[model samples]
Target: MPGFTLHPFTLLTASTVFMILPVTVQPAITTPINAALHAVAGPSDATDRYRALVRRLADNDPRWEVQTAAWSALISDVPTAVTDFLSPGGGYEKARARASQNASRNALVISRTISTTTATTSPIVHLTAIRASYGTLAEKDRYVRTGLKEAQDLDAKHSPVEQARQQAQQDRDYVADIALHGSGAWVRAAAQRAIQKSTDNDIQEFFKYSWASAAGCDLQAFRMNLVEQDLAYRHRLAQLIVLAQQAQHAYEQASEAAKAKAAAEARLAWSTAADTAAATQASWLANQQLAAAQAQSWQQVHDFAVTASTQQDWPTIADNAAGTSGSWSDEVAWAQSQAAEWTAVYESAKASADALPGANPTVSPSPTA
Candidate 1:
């Protein structure tokens, strides 16, 4: 009968004790939170520590479980603090802003590095082009100078502009010609740089036109020298022509003068020779006449004297004839007297002829009748 009795008080007390023990006061979760904070250093360490804390908190609190989910999603691939996490319409708008700023900063740094590399390498390429262009220009300049000097040394004739312009043109053409011929990569690069660097339209246009003009690289230097040479040759030809004319004129004048002088000498010589021949003829004629007259006079005297000698008885006749005959001379003595008189007359005539006007011995005698 003692085993059959039921106790409601004992059953109520057992249920109450079970409920109270299950719902008792828990220790603070601050200890694990402190541990997680202390472990934070870098992103990797922070991520590990945060994950562990999330698991611990998930054991007790529903809010902790929710926070853990959010943190897990935030730091999964992106290592970050829970305080710096981002979500739409969340209370971490500032945290999101900070994270975006950090990303932008990193991007800017990478961009600067790339820009520096390009700037440095680009100049080197440009420099190489410039060096090539310089070599081409220098070679062209040297060739031009050689041609110019040769022309100068040889005294080649040319126009004034051609002579001076060749030198200036060589300098200008070297750059321009190289650009036109595309002789060097540097030339194109330099031109581009100049255009890019300069803001002025004048400078840009100048380079463009200059380069275009130099493209041909012809033999302008030789042509210029040739022009000068042509001018000099013309001058020399003119001088020769003038000298020939002068010589011809002088020869003509001299020939005329010589002819006149010869004519005058002939005239004088003919007149002198004729006068001498006439004087000689006149003297010989006079001597013959005088001798004949003297012979006649002597014959008359001799005949009369002979007649008186035969008639001696007539003394008066004999005396008269003798006196007349005594005055007469011999033929030889009379001829001598006539010759002396003619000689004096001929000498006077020769002196008078010599003093006559227009009597030049150097000229020849003129025509006579």
Candidate 2:
């Protein structure tokens, strides 16, 4: 009674109610009930039925609600039946019988739950679908692995090769940039050809040949330019040396002319001084002789005056003394004037001869050729 109270109808109650009902009506009621139960329960194949039930449970499917309600009602009877069979008042033999019955009933309830929740599917169809899906995934994985390996191999092979190609392209661009703007027609044409070459290899070869040719031309041009510069420099140096030697020779000739002119001027100055000195000396000697004659005339006049004064002849003494005194005074004045004039000339001539170059009388004068 205690366990049965939880359910709306017990198994005993249902049996009793059926027994009370007439046999003719029993089939009608039982038939519809069995049909309803079958509708709620699913197909017989366990795996496909389970997959269907899980699909119904997902996505808020309405089938899951009906199946859940039915499962609840079915399992509600199990706990009550088990509780009543295992109650404490039973003896050992009865307990053993009840336990076995309870176990059987529990197993039946579980079996009914599984059967009602599942739908039927053929084993062959289920296996085929599974194999197709799995095969697709496996094949895709195999393809992905193979593609990744090939990609890795290609990258490893071409990395350095691509880098070298890029470097070569850069070098070609540098050369082309210069040559395209260069002065020479051939170099520029070569640069254009290098640019138009189809492959990196061809382009590199073109650049190589062009550079070699340009270098040779540049070397020849440089040599010609250097030679021209060197020759011009040498010619200029020789001309400067000739001009310097001519200038030096002219300077030496001019210096000798200046020395000869200076020596001639000195000789002329000495000769002029020597002639003046000789004239001054001759004039001084003549003046000295005239002074001696004047002095003798004065002495003769003084003796005549003394002889006349002793004879007492006043007139003759006055006349002779006055005439002689006048004559002597005039002569003395003339001698003094000539002596001063000659002395000045002699002193000036001696000074001029002393100041001239090489005018020392002890050093004989050099003959001027």
Candidate 3:
């Protein structure tokens, strides 16, 4: 645990899981959808095809409310029900839509169930819940019917203590990644200490409470780095101003033959600096606007999550909302800092260019992003 290091992208995977959940496509009972679609092609063949479709619908293993409706059609007058089931906007399509609605509601319940402390503590259930939360409606339907039992069976293979031991190894891999790539020295140290403790309780502590402390430490480090960068930018500008003054003086004192060339070179140097600085300034301004928009987008997500908690009672939305808020908030801070820094650089460069000899100070770089 002392020197554990993982690839940097390992943390990217660790942090963003819902974006990349594994999809296991289970084989369905054959001909279900095809049987429905082709059931009423013509009156001659409709009888056989309708029976085939009914059998297929009946055979859905983890079928939702749709199967019950299919049974209703099966028990009624066969010829009339068959046509009704097969025609456009008919019994089969309505059943499926109802099933989809049921699946959606089940997905919400499953999300809240797995986010419960008892369930979240189990790694297998946690994994299953993530798949259900981000998965499609069909996937959620299958998960609601079968995935919970599968997760429970997997969890039963080991004692709770053993499961926790296995989970600690996974957490160690994540903490090791943080130790290497986390923003501040303090955060890295905090990650390292969690890895060294090598206990399930300690790792849980790190995830639950210590992560906020580490983030606070990184905030201080970020501010310090911003100051360092701003000071370096100003010092570079000071150097450029001094060079421009020295070149102007040199051009004035140059002999007749060299004065023209000297003046030309000084003007070119200051003009190029102004051009480069202005380009950087515009780039940062655009980046600032983009960052602000991203922050606003995350705020919308947070608002939706709040609404979901009340309307749908989905508590799990809060975790994703909080993570996106923190990440986008960083973007907002960086954009603001860089935009201000580059504006200063551009102003200094422009002033130096204007004071240089033999340059048309009125000529400015185009202000375009």
Using TM-score as the measure, the top candidate is 3
Best by lDDT: 3
Clashes found in each candidate (C-alpha, N, C closer than 3 A): 22, 5, 0
Writing each residue's lDDT as its tens digit, candidate 2 over 223-333 gives 222222222322232233333233334444556547545544544443453344345345434534433443343344345435432212335534543553454344345
Cα lDDT, model 1, residue 24: 19
- Show pairs that collide, candidate 2: 41-116, 43-118, 43-119, 43-120, 49-119
Worst 10 residues of 2 by lDDT: 13-22
Q: Scored by CA lDDT, what does every candidate get? A: 0.31, 0.34, 0.51
Q: How does candidate 1 fare on TM-score?
A: 0.17
What digit string (tens of lDDT, one per residue) describes model 3 on residues 1-369? 123232331222122111111112222222232232222112234345445445445544133455676688777765567546643456655765675578668877787857672533676666566545544445566677888778777777743432333443545665677677643345466677778877775566455445445544333333323323333333343344445555666887999989888888777656665565566566556545544544454354455445441222224434654664566476566656556545554555566556655667668854543
Which runs of model 1 end up more than 4 angstroms from their true locations?
1-256, 310-369
Taking all chains together, each candidate's TM-score versus the true structure is 0.17, 0.24, 0.36
**RMSD in order of candidates:** 77.0, 79.5, 25.7
lDDT of model 2 at position 316: 51
